[model samples]
Target: MLLNGLKVVEFASYIAAPGAAGILADWGAQVIKVERPGGDAMRHVFADAKSELSGNPTFEMDNRGKRSVVLDISKPRGREALARLAAKADVFLTNVRASSLKKSGLDEPTLRKANPRLIYAMVTGYGLEGTEAETPGFDVTAFWARAGVAMMTTPKGHDPFLLRTGVGDHTTSLATVSAILAAVYEREHTGVGRLVQTSLLATGVYTVGSDLAVQLRFGRLASNKPRTAPFDPVANFYRSADDRWFVVNPRGGAVDWPVLTKVAGRPELTEDERFRTSRSRKDNSALLVAELDAAFGAMAFDEIARRLNEADLAWAPAQTPAEVAADPQLRAAGALVEVDDGSGRAHLSPAAPAVFPGLDPGVLPPCPALGRDTRKVLEEAGFSAADIEAMYDEGAAA
Candidate 1:
């Protein structure tokens, strides 16, 4: 594996930081997840939801293949144990607030002072230096809402909706992973570690950067329109005869207009004055969309798919979760893999995003039970048996 022998000590909960660490673990890093006594709150994310079960795929996806060590960092002993872990770790990852980290003596200065070569990767809702640096933020609030993604994504005149779970966190996870790897490379030359920081808000802004860039440059942006009334009729979703929806993206404008019209069985319409040119189409996009909708609604999904293919029009079906799960392309690409639950049961889970050409990403191990590796991790950190016992007795270690 590319990151073989790399050691990461993760002090984070929920998705962002832990998700980044999970990717490092997939690439062959030994990751030790430092959890509170009751473990990450994500452990109970599905507790009150439908399909309640002892095992949670949500928690597993971000924590797989990592060892969990329970510690109450508010306690002096627990803070001491974490400091010891950071002293030996090649990388220290955390999503804990900057103020809390500083108060607990786990800030970058303290950790980097002990291990100058450590890569300190910090994930936050806002950032480390702002007034809201210590403000608690979740992906939905910071990433989606505060970052303008929610407003930008909501259709004009429609109420805002919640983002899908962990979408922003996972996106930020990719960013953090990239930053950590860069810092790791830099450390090889500088012989010193660096503080790499990323935030959900920042990641969200970047995710919607294309539109945001336009808004910034032009000082204005058109509100997001409904699919049926998009800025470009060629870039919209339409339903087939059987109610299967698919989107077309005629990005080449004039070149694709004819092809798209032909695919919709309306080649004659392309010659019409109101729809002949891109400008005219945009001016009357709603009417064009209505015409395409009627045409597509009269064709079966297979016929529409075949016609689109024949015309070389760019399009994709709006797949459901079930359809996505059965997609052959995803299966062949290793987008998902079977993971053991440690109790001998195996279930399919998402694989790391990147694939190394010559290395196996490795089978994902089960998410550890809370405090599962507390004793072992402490021992490996050079704590004596007596010391470990005393910490446990003091409720500092579990």
Candidate 2:
């Protein structure tokens, strides 16, 4: 409830921008989500030719605890309503392409003229100024592919793979949220709002910043190798006798090398000339990995875990999604939450990332049905009941 009085008017669909607004909503902002008549396409992501699905967790994750208003912005009436909402809102968030926004008179200049205190936040694919400024882009295309994240992450010889769903969008969402908060803070002193912007491409570049820094400095970079052929044998994954895969990353330097060898019951390997130093181990990583693989393959995960812990080495099991869901650590850290659906049913969902020490963001409300708050929002925006009805009748509002 930290943002209890904050009002965010969100004119975005899909993940990144909406996700930033969703976090604001979770923190008790009154978020009004504007959608087209058909609703956000995310609402039907799980649909098939046979039947539309009953539940959409993907949409719910980024849209819960917000009000939905369907508006056909192409219509003057709907655009006027949105402008009215912006005049009163503390923040206006959108991912709509620049050209369309300008054509509809919903651009930053127009909105800010009516409300100088409005924090206009925009999320884009490339950026606000570029040849592809208006290009349609998803996180996969903009963040993963065009930003070089996919290229650097994929194994050298294997075909590039897709990122897990919402990975890049959620990252960009966090960035957008941070920028919005910074602008909000500045507005307090200046009494003027500013245009805050983030893009999937920029966020992706920052995500791999360390690697990109190396590429910039060296003018070249090493490709990601397969797990079995990593650059660091000490920081590699192996399977145990029980077939549980786990990764180990000992501390930097050669201090833990001999300790690892002894822990694997291959103490004699500590003196092996080929594996004596860090450089030697990396140069002969394949051979060292094969040796460790054989040793780990002979032990159950429990034994391996015990030995690794006793040796003070850093390691963790490579668990599946199901395992992660049941992980006690996730709950202990408050990463998981139960949201109250309208029917009073509590369904598990991920909590917003940050945790304020003293304030508790209470139980989150369910995602609103499409156009659920259209009439209410319009009435609050000062439209008469007759005007609201006319808009609905004319298909300007739903």
Candidate 3:
């Protein structure tokens, strides 16, 4: 138990914030997630319609190994109870907006005064200051839409795809984790803690830092790697005769053109200067793509992949979510975990991405029912039974 003596209180939901807490849970931290009486909204997003316990797959994977307490902090006493928990916590993390923090009295200064050693982490939409700071945000709203990601990803004539899952949320979550770990490391020398923060928009911007720099430094959107810059005949996905897909990115230099031409049964193309070099091919990429497409159209995807593999060409079959779940490499690596799923049934899901040898890389707790750990958490906090009852009567706790 690496975190046997450490206690973490996470007042976050969805992807970005809870992701940091999930890391701690993986490392054996005694983490208690603070949710509202009805539970965090994420818990209900992907739940099976007929089974309440099904919860969101995103939440289940991110929140494993952490206990939950559904306490409303809307009232004075509720906030006071939360403060008490903070006083005992080694770390405090929240994804609520800055204004909301001030409103709830859970801001960093307030929590630091209660526990100087606390590693305070805050996650926001646009960051601590900006017009959008106080504005409401979601993963798509803050990360993909507002952060210039959509523009870069969208093909010229297509509606940009906002990722189906938590791309920015999970990315920013790793940022938060990196910050928290640094703060914890610094505590060893300073014997004090500091506030660490990250935002979905900020993280997305960082992910595309190189492109942003080019645009800012040169006053031009990138035209060197423009989408119209024809796809390399050898370095692209192709649909086979059977309508199955395979990506083949063999060596892209002129020297490697012979390898692909041989596969296409058109060795004469290697001698044609129009398709000889990469630069010339770029001038006629459509022709090259059409030629390769025709060649692939004559074979099954599996057969194409095999021939390309034997020819030392890099190739792989396009896989779906179901195929990904059963990937042989992933299974051998124990990256997917099996859970009872609280339905007298079992389901396998992806586990945390990294692992430490000799440590239990397992889920310590499953997603909880609303208020599932309310009584237990209160008792642990030294609240008497009558006092707890009084709190319920006052509508401060659930």
For lDDT, candidate 1 versus 3, the one ahead is 1
* Model 1 residue 76 lDDT score: 98
RMSD to the true structure for each prediction, in A, is 1.3, 1.4, 2.8
Candidates' TM-scores?
A: 0.97, 0.97, 0.90
Clash-forming residue pairs, model 3: none
Residue-level error in angstroms, candidate 3, position 273: 1.6
Judged by whole-model lDDT over C-alpha atoms, candidate 1 comes out at 0.91
- TM value for model 1: 0.97
Assess each prediction's global lDDT (C-alpha) against the native. Answer: 0.91, 0.92, 0.78
| lDDT (Cα, tens digit) per residue for candidate 2, span 169-285 | 999999999999999999999999999999999999999999999999999999898888789988999999999999999899988988899878899888899888888888998
Range of the 10 consecutive residues with the lowest summed lDDT in candidate 1: 355-364
lDDT of 3: 0.78
Stretches > 4 Å off in candidate 1: 50-54
lDDT, model 3, position 122? 88
Most lDDT-accurate candidate: 2
